[model samples]
Target: MQTAGSIQAQMVGRSGVVATLALCFIIALLEGVDNQSMGVAAPFVARHFGFSPAQMGLAFSIGSLGLLPGAMLGGRLADRLGRKPVLIYSVVVFGIFSIMTAHIWDANSLIFSRFMTGLGLGAAMPNLIALVSEIVPDRLRRTAVSFMYCGIPLGGAIASAIGALSVEGGQWRHVFYVGGFAPLILVPLLIFLLPESRNFLASTVQKEGRIRPAAISTVLFGERRTVLTIALWVTFFFTLSILFFLMNWLPSLLVRQGIKPAQVGVIQVLFNVGGAVGAMGFGWLMDRTRAWMVVLCTYVGIVVALVVLSQSGALGMIYLGAALAGLFLIGAQSILYGLSAVYYPIVMRGTGSGSAVAVGRFGSFFGPFAAGELLAMGFAPPLLIGAAVPLIVIALISTLVVVKRPVVKN
Candidate 1:
């Protein structure tokens, strides 16, 4: 028979895992809110700042640009220092900058604030992924990560709700105020309640005993990891490009297509709500089914949704299309994140995941900027959205390669 002490320990461990997952979920939700805040608030921000399409695109892309360096640096620091402290610091950075966003007086100030917010946002994700991955068993990893990530879309739905409420009143700054303050409020709870990754702690002890972790280049590119890295990066880049494009520009496109602001908010809310459901559902499927089947279904869903979004005219149809788009697009993105977590071992997981995310940030940066330029050049909304189909196909191909390869543990 099992000893009572051992069972108690197991129970404590399970509770710890639950707590960590819950905290990570909350943070992910906050990130979703901040990320979508600008998108939902864009119309009002542009009007208040007198920003043209191209300039507004620049604003959207700049925050993503900050994500690049932030991911690289944050991932590196998490490995070197620790996940808990780095994550806390990142939350503080983003929270402060998010608050600053509401107070910006001009374009330069706005850019600066958002870039800093992006830095914090980028930094937090790798740690979140790393921490959750380390805590969960292999069988439960995907579902757990997806469960945490579902917070993002739900949080985004909250932002959309805020936008819907504030849009008529020109209370765009209120969105930022909420995004900025909530994370800060959550900080103390994180400090007291959150635990560092046991895997990271173990690795740190090994490093102290003269068994240093592998060099960064070796961790990412050595031991037959090159192909896997490239495939993962490709998947991240294209997937994120389309996802961010839809996120940042979809509302504006609907408005241009003669949709009312109130209705646009409804579509956005449905989009994120569908995303939250899809993230969890597909993640469950990925855990239970063949990855290729999930990949095929996800990409096909994305294509069909895009087509519907572009071609449909009725509000209900558009709403359905938007929801489907969010369902597959965000679902696929969450799957990629889970894959990255499992692909690398605890020693280099942060850097591996971070690098992939940083590269994806490049695509995220380009998507909105490119779309803005295209729209400025008189591209139709349908044409612009249709263009994402090829990128989705490309992402599907690369993601298949990634899932087929054996995961690297050392």
Candidate 2:
């Protein structure tokens, strides 16, 4: 006779699994659109409001501030409640706030709206990672997670395309409208079609009888998991910082580098395209090799790519460098999500993944802020790109540590 766990796993067959994956992918894609929409519309928004660069940077960072709390609350709630409810509610929250963004009149209002939107984005992510991790076959789990994550860059590319053609022509509010409305449309489908995580129901609730809420500290650092948890946080912090720095500032920076206004969109699209490819390719490699080894190599690739970008004056070299950087930097971050899923058990998976993201979101806030400060100081592109090298090196070393001392599963 099949055990409860085995039966639950089997309940969602191949087609059901595929459907779930598709839903998760769409959720992630919407998240990408919602988050990147701000960056894509930043130049236009700044001009419209007559805001200074510092004010714009603050606007960018403020959204991430909301994500910190959102991730923490959402992840724990998902653990205590069910993943489906939290996931659905998160989408609703962000969608409503995103629509409100279209009506903002000043810096403060924009910040408030984006911050509220961040909460939903933050909450939805951990559950998505945990759900995808639990449902997929063990061997394919990493690849499945990575595949879902590719939606982030794909959405970014889509946002960039829209912004280049439409928003630049003074239709910035349309970006937010699209971001807000599409997710609202998805909510109905999510309500009707999304299934509760079987593993959360079986392994978490059934095993405990009554849910004993695990503290974030106890869940992450308990069972001698401290070193691994810390390393994961460090890795997440640095990688996400770099990723967001580029995501938020790259277009403006490229324009400042004498690149034509029209060409910035193409570079952003190319960057995201490379990111999607790298994420899928590295994910495949992670399943076959030492996962840390794959991550380490990716960070090294990021360093090399940054160096080339720093020195390049030619358009081809600049484009090539951006693509390579995105491939490795964004790709490696996707793999880290998969790694976080693998590190925690079903019971604490939401908390573990969410906490890591919360920490990373803290780091993400600094990326755009620091870039703005540096730009204010008149720092050149080469110096800004060069600064990322040490962070990537730190990430590379952190991966080595994770590999050497694996976290004990709870």
Candidate 3:
């Protein structure tokens, strides 16, 4: 690690969480890029291996599969091992596997590498989210989580922009090069600049006794928080199911629609632009009112956007609909994360958020595979309409009914 001032020193007066936010955003951005990066590269890879779109979809799903286990393991690791080591290990392992993905030649090796990358990527977040929530003051937690989630859109847009540019000459490998290299650049910065979360450290101690893993289990899964955590997980899982479907399916689906491959990236940009706007906007909204309320409304908006996008034949209408779909779809998912920060106390924060994210990760894993399966069955673009994404999310949000209780649990 670099010899910069400790996190405690940096967090001295008040500006610490801001710094933590920056780091968390970077981590979240890298995670998002890893998640969607394969989609942008899949077309070229399919052509190279003579694989069908369905096969490619399965491969993309494998990366998400890795995330499922990683999320579970990473969360526990963060609780037991301390957040810094877990984060560092994930970045290094994730980066190494990502680079390996660019080098694999056969389908099996490629799938394996992608899956491993998913594991590293999956492992990183719980620690990061857990760390970030605890590092900030209660008043800032929601906003901080919201801001970090914005990385999803920014990273997706980055992939689109990069893929669009690099794929100009049909050199898809170049896209992987950028994806694999990005984390490397951040690896050193993370080691040098980032500090261990004070809250996570403090969490090691409890009221009745010292911080035991059993205490965390009881506090989170005891009587009250378990159902709430499950609801949060369902909310994210459904949101991701549709979100991943769109991220991976949109480009190929547009291609099948007779839209130019080049223009597909442009379409992705519209969706991501809307996502950034929605996430940022929703984050601000969460601070002012109940997170569940904001998420519920966003889901409704997404349903409307999807319905319009699915049916609208006009390009302008399609753009507007996709953008609006992204706005609701991405923002609603992020709002739950904001809720996680505020809903749990500092001690159980990582375990709380980690459990939700870990469970939600299966959606990330299954989403692309389902899209691929649907497409393989010769599904029509309109049939698999954009509205499907938000529809699933609406069901998930209905499960997360948070009471407007106040404790300031600081």
Question: Which stretches in model 3 have alpha-carbon errors above 4 Å?
Answer: 1-15, 206-211, 215-220, 386-400, 403-408
The stretch of ten residues in a row with the least summed lDDT in candidate 1 is 3-12
C-alpha lDDT values of all predictions: 0.88, 0.83, 0.73
| Candidate 3 lDDT score relative to the true structure | 0.73
| Inter-residue clash pairs, candidate 1 | none
Tell me, what's the RMSD of every candidate? Answer: 3.3, 2.2, 3.8
Residue-wise C-alpha lDDT for candidate 2, range 70-138, written one tens digit per residue: 888888998988788999999999999999999998788899998999899999989888878877777
| Higher-TM-score candidate of 1 and 3 | 1
Task: Give the backbone clash total of model 2.
Answer: 0
Worst 10 residues of 2 by lDDT: 401-410
Q: Write the candidate numbers in order of decreasing TM-score.
A: 1, 2, 3
Over 248-287, each residue of candidate 1 has an lDDT whose tens digit, in order, gives 9999999998999999999999999999998999988988
**TM-score on alpha carbons, each prediction:** 0.95, 0.95, 0.90
